[model samples]
Target: MKLSFNIALRFLNSSKGQTFLIALGIAIGVSVQIFIGSLIQGLQIDLVDTTIGSQPQITITSTSDDKLIGDYESRLSDISSDYEGVKHVSPSADGPALVTSDEENYSILVRGLSFEAAEGIYKTKERLVEGSLPENKNEVLIGTTLKDESGIQIGDEVDVLTSSGENQALTVTGIFDFQVANLNSSWVLTTLETAQSMFSYDDRITGIEMQVEDVFLADTISSDIQADLPEDLLAENWKDQNASLLSGLNGQSVSSYMIQVFVMISVLLGIASVLAITVVQKSRQIGILKAMGIRDSAASLIFVFQGLMLGIAGAILGILLGLGLAYVFTRFALNPDGTPVVPLYINPGFIALSAGFAIVVSTLAALIPARKSSKLNPIEVIRNA
Candidate 1:
């Protein structure tokens, strides 16, 4: 084995250009695989994060005509205890209200939440662009668009009118942008106590908002939660709410896999063709070694060792190149606010998989040449020469 390896090294070292060029080809192929796989995966992650990761994955709402989920604390307790996947549970009272501004009434959903609990899902603190969260009944937070349109300052008083003729004068304590235009223009936030009072729902909330560890498992979790819930209530998940988005995501994943597979096949074929030519080019050297009583197995082993060395060299180069390309993309592909258009999401496992796969393909590609090497007759080669 050692003799075979040494011979393989000498053969490769004899023709440095061929060795380097073959490895370079393999490296380029592997690099593309890593880059495209990582890029698509990153884009998918960003899409999912914006669509559902930042928001509630599961929700519990009432079927009753009043549209209120009663006994929510008990339900919250059950979910928090029974479901290990459940990350955050926030019971909220949400309904429509009008914000009167200069003879025009702007309609918005008044959402009441337990700030600390809701923070896990909404990340309210991070989204707050001004002032602070509402801490008092008289204080509230409005969306950025609402704040802009109404010209309402942090301390400005907001006149809120309910559909049922109940009116309340509240002060704007903060402003937030949820990143969705509809949410920014049509949502108002306040504490749970205040919303319940405003809606006159004693000890009851309209819905229970929840986030889970895995966004994709929301449907399963929600269905299981439904089975455990009272008949008067139902559990809904983000997946059911966004079917088209999920379909698009699955399609993207399929397309990415297809591209990677074709790249890998091309790489294997390139390595096989190059190594086959190497066998022919080194026929004289291999004939001399076989004439010196080297076994057929060892002759085959020589080409296998060359394949392994090439695979190792190419895989390492490819990994570094791929990572560099991804880094450059993130740094250069900026949005208007100087953020990367597609934020890089690096998975160490995926990178490792790509490298390992390239190496395996390189080794397998050498098998054809290895078989030919074993079958070579030293006597015939000497006679021809």
Candidate 2:
């Protein structure tokens, strides 16, 4: 085995330029694979973050009793104790309300929540453009779009008309920018008590909002939660709410796999052709080795060793190149605030998989050439020479 490896190394070194070129081709292919894989992963993460990073992965709401959930506190405790992925279970009371400012009325989604629980999912405090989360039932936090459209600001008192025909004056204590235009334009954040009082619900909440440790497992967790709850109570997950987004992500994955498969085929063909040419060029040498009593198995191993060497060397170079490309992109691709457009998180497992795939593909490409070399006739080759 050592002798076959040494011979393979010598043959490759003998044609240094050709060997380098073939390795370069492999490097380029592997580099593309790494970059594309990393890029796609980053994009998917960004998309998920934008969609649900500050939103509940699972939401529990009542199908009966006009959006009121009975014994929400007990239900929340049961869910926390029973569920595996449960991170934070926040109770919220939300309903449409008419907000009147200087004789102009705007319909908004008035959501009542506790700051501690709301912050866990929405990170509302972090996104506070001005002031802070409402401290009491009398104070409320309005979105930036609502502030701009209605000319409302902190310390301003606004009249809210609830669904039950009850009206109350609430003070805006802060303004937040959720970044989503619809949320910014329509959401009015208040306290659970305030929302219940306005909606005429005595100690009852509209629903329970929840965040999970694994966002992708929301569907399964939600179903389990639903099964554990009353028939009137239903659990909805992010996956169910964002079917279109999931479809798009699936399409992207399929396309990426297709591209990778084609790239591997191209790399395989390139290595195979080069090895075939090398076999023809080294026919006399192979015949001489065979005549010297080298087994066919050992002769075949020579080409296999060459393939492995090329794969290992090329994969190393490719990984370096891929990392460099990712770094360059992160540095150059920036937003107005100097943050990266898409964050690149290189997974070590993914890198290892890419390297392993390249190595295996290269080895397989050498099989045909190895078989031809093993079948070579020493007499015929010597006479032809």
Candidate 3:
């Protein structure tokens, strides 16, 4: 084995230009594959984050006519204890409300929540564009769109009429921008107690909102939660709610895989063709060695070892080049806000996979040349010469 490897190294060393060219080809192929794969992954992550990052991936709501869930505290506890993926769980009460300011009236979604618990999902505190989260009774946070449309601001009182025929004057303590136009325009966030009082629900909530550790796994978790719940309670997931978005994401992934596969095929064919040519170029040396009684098996191993060494060098170079390209792209591709339009999401596992994939493909590509070299006619070569 050592002898074959040494011979392989010597053969590659003898043709420095050829070796470098082959490695460069492999490097370019690997780098392109890595760049595309990383870009697609980052785009998918950003899309998912923008869609549901600060929202409930799963929700438990009642199907009864009143549309309110009683014993929500016990339900919250059960959900938290039963599922490890349930990262944040909060009870909420939401209903339609209208704000009458001057001669204009604006329709809004009045959601009552425990800010401390809701913080994990909504990130209301972090997303605050003004003032602070609602801390006092009748104090609430309005969305940016509402603030602009109604010309309302901190310290201003908003007179709200609820669907349940109750009226209250809410003090604006803060304003938040969820980045979703609808949410920004319509959400009037307040305390859970305030909502219950306004809606005349003694101790009940509209539903239980939850965020999971893995957003993709929400469907399975929601199904499991539904199976265990009573008939009147329904568990819903974001995947089910936004079917079109899920379909679009799936299509993107399929396209990305197809591109990667085609790239790999092209690289493999290049390596195989080069190695086959190498065999013909070194035929005389191989024939002499075989005539001297070096076994065909040993002869075959020479090309295999050469392939492996080339693969190692190419894989390392490719990884570095790919990483550099990704970094450069993110740095230059800016959004109006100075953030990368496509943020770099480096997955170490994926980088390792790409390197391993290139190495394996390269080694396989040398097999054709190795087989041909093993069958070289030693006697015929010398006689012809």
Candidate 2 stretches greater than 4 Å from native: none
TM-score of 3: 0.98
lDDT of 2 by residue, 1-385 (tens): 9999999999999999999988888888888888888988899989998999889999988889587887888888888899998999899999998999879999999999987877889898988989977877778999999999999989999999987788889999999999998999899999999888888888999889999998999999998888878788889999998999999999988998889889988999999999989999999999999999999999999999999999998899889998888889999999999988888879888888888899999999999899989999998998898
Tens digit of per-residue lDDT, candidate 3, span 1-385: 8888999999999999999998988888778878988998999999999889989999998999998899889889999999878999999999899998876999998999999999999988889988998877888899899888889989999899998778899999999999888989999999999888878888999989999999999999998899899999999999999999999999998998898888888988998999899888889889999999999999999999988888888889998898899999999999999999999989889888988998999899989899999999999876765
How many clashing residue pairs are found in candidate 3? Answer: 0
Per-residue error (Å), model 1, residue 308: 1.4
lDDT by candidate, in order shown? 0.90, 0.90, 0.91
lDDT for each residue of candidate 1 in 156-231, tens digit (9 for 90 to 100): 8879997677998988999999998889889899999999998898899999999999889999999999998878
Candidate 3 residues lying further than 4 Å off, grouped into runs, are none
For all predicted structures, in order, the TM-scores are 0.97, 0.97, 0.98
Which of 1 and 3 is ahead in TM-score? Answer: 3
Error of 2 at 269 (Å): 0.6
- Which of the numbered candidates is closest to the native, going by highest TM-score? 3
- Residue-level lDDT for 130 in candidate 2: 96
